[model samples]
Target: MDRWVCRREKRRLAIDQENHLGYRRFYNVMWYCFRQRGSILSISNSSGAKSEQRKGKGSDRVVAVLERMGAERIYGVPGEEILDIMESLRKSKKIKFVPTRTEWGAALMAATEGRLTGRPGVSLATCGPGALNFPNGAEYAHLGGFPLVMIAGQKPINSSLHGHFQVSPLVSVMEGLTKYAVQIGSVQMIRPVFSEAFRIAQEEKQGPVSVVIPEDIAAEECEEDEL
Candidate 1:
């Protein structure tokens, strides 16, 4: 009984320490300090340092770009493959996530949010089945003239061509549902794809633009300068 109690106490202490550190780190990131060394320093002087480090490659670049464009929230149903991107968003705190019960509901809510706020509402869905569920809401956004962005997770490129589970030809599937549909197969293609998608959704006819993110590509390590 004593051993168990002691273990419990240690666990509690660890959790408390973690919570304290997290709070301090958040504070520091929100309040960076200018230094004479020609570099900005984070106040907390801990893991917040990592937060100050500029995004170099991969999903980090994507999150930074979204933040730069002033996106405050993302509405979606979490999927297995996109969890890394989700974690990246959580760390940045630039975009809050609104998890919906269904993929279709996410799309509808994104459309409504976009219309009400007059800012693009972003939604994420897993590939294959998830993408299939989004067309209805995409069509509604199109008819209503709302600007929205939907990202669907796709199977890795290797698995995609060889026929893996949940693999589908997303570009062909979403072709007519929105003004633009792009399946990003490589890290080099991420920026152009994002730029074009944003243009299609916000300009021209003002409707949803779908960008299919493959699992392998989303997990790739992006260099800091690329962002």
Candidate 2:
């Protein structure tokens, strides 16, 4: 009987020890996960602070508005007229820039994205021929009621750097292909204009909207309040 009791005690002690060890291991794993999560949150906070400290430019504000509007991707062919926008896109973490071989491809991709996602898909292009490439895709989106936003670059409007070279009546052309089309003539108009465009693009009978931004305006510094 004593031997039996002794064996039972030994088994109980072993089980207890095993349970304790398992609990300790569980606690350790939980602590490790907590530490890892803390580190990741701190890194994100630091990066957010850095972005806040960075100077706000027109293109940066434009990209910011796009992020706020929930645009996840921008399809385009980069050009000299949109260098500032390209730089801003490169710095953005929320919205990815997709480079295409041609403006037509970019517009088609954006239209497809809009059709699939049920949100306004964004496309970018330079003035003149690049801007003109959007018509076919824009019309397709407009007719199909797929929400789309088309952004096109232009030479400096405030200066004569390009001297009317490669200029086209882009807004007028796009007006027929999209639900709404306008040119952003001032830095202050970026936020409201983009907001309205996004809103309109998603409204009833959803269709394409077009915006034209000049190179100089995109490169200009934006006021803090504007951001």
Candidate 3:
């Protein structure tokens, strides 16, 4: 009986010691973390470095040009392919991104806006199915002679990883329904190509126009001259 009691006491003491050591180790680790965090905060505060403006991207230039030319809003259903352009649109003060329930709904909204305002109304769509939805609205604008500008996304032009997957001949499909349809091949082509598209949309007997920008091209850094 005495032996069993002594063994029990020793086990209890051992457990107590282990618990105490664990608590001490935890406290030390927490103290070390707090000290490191304070040092990092002090270094950052003392450095006094001004945050630089983000570099301009092709998507930024696209939004800038549209804002400069008097587009008030762009209507679209966003997708991964157009994420860069959507981010650029999000940062614009003058041009707003108008989310719609469907790509077709966005196209119709743009068409109505163009008809009412007598200016080119812009709509955006992602590649493949998203872009395919615009033809009906484009036809409506074409038949009614309303000025409209439609922008569509494309797979990365430089990538062959997913060759022709989810990629249709957008330019060809859009051509039949629009006054002008062209794919932008590079960041440098954005300004000029869009300028021409806008011009064509406003020309005599105005109709819908389509412009396609590749996912990779839209995310590239824009040259100062291009911007």
Candidate 4:
């Protein structure tokens, strides 16, 4: 009878130890996942120069690439300069554009969508005042650790120094609020900048990335291969 009791006690102790070890392992995995989520939601500068090259048809190319990257919807306020790209997206059917009443609203919606889904969210704005309105949303995404991509129309490169109707140095304004910021002026620079922007926004420390597209450049022709 004593031997039976001893054996039973030993089995109980072994089961208890196994349960304890399993709980500890689960706790550790949960902690690791949380940490990884935080890192993916911020900007990391370690990716190097290869991440920022310009390729394709500048802004148009960017839209195509975003669609290819699994972006089914874009939230933003449309303006004259960005209309062409919007039209293209509409026709593609691969992505749908959601128009917002205000640029700020668009930004907020994009950030919120990104938070809910693991995919990156996109917001668009026209140059000048339109671009200025997005900083608030951008800041929200940055602090909230959401993946967001902001595209803004820019004054022609020639008018960048001078002042156009709603001209603002958008790239400079968005610098601190985003993980990455690029002003797309040349066709050759679009691919690299876009690749980097997507990388930054989706990294382990996810945040916002802004791409400013110059007016003239957006209308320029891109080589067939580049497209």
Q: Poorest 10 consecutive residues of model 1 by lDDT?
A: 33-42
The alpha-carbon deviation from the true structure for residue 57 of candidate 4, after best TM-score superposition, in angstroms, is 5.1
What is the number of residue pairs that collide in model 2? 0
Name the candidate that leads on lDDT.
2
**Model 4 lDDT tens row, 1-227:** 99999999999999999999999999999999989876765434334222443323455676677776788888888888787677667667688889899999999999999999967798989988888999999999999999999989876785545646777888899999999988986877777777888888999789999999887777776754575
Which scores greater on TM-score, model 1 or model 4? 1
- List, residue by residue over 64-172, the lDDT tens digit for candidate 1: 7778767888888888868767877878877898888888898999998889987778888888897788898899999999988888888778553574777788889
RMSD from true fold, candidate 4: 20.6
Give me the displacement of residue 67 in model 4, in angstroms.
1.4
In the range 94-160, model 2's lDDT, one tens digit per residue, is: 9999999888888889988999999999999998899999998898888899999999999888976
TM-score of 2: 0.75
Summing lDDT over every window of 10 consecutive residues in candidate 3, give the lowest-scoring window. Answer: 46-55
If scored against the real structure, what TM-score would every candidate get? 0.73, 0.75, 0.75, 0.71
Question: Local error of candidate 3 at 103, Å?
Answer: 0.8
In angstroms, how far off is 22's CA in candidate 1?
A: 49
Highest TM-score: give the candidate number: 3
Better of 1 and 3 by TM-score: 3
Which rank order by TM-score, best down to worst?
3, 2, 1, 4
Q: How far is each candidate from the true structure, as Cα RMSD in Å?
A: 17.5, 11.8, 10.2, 20.6
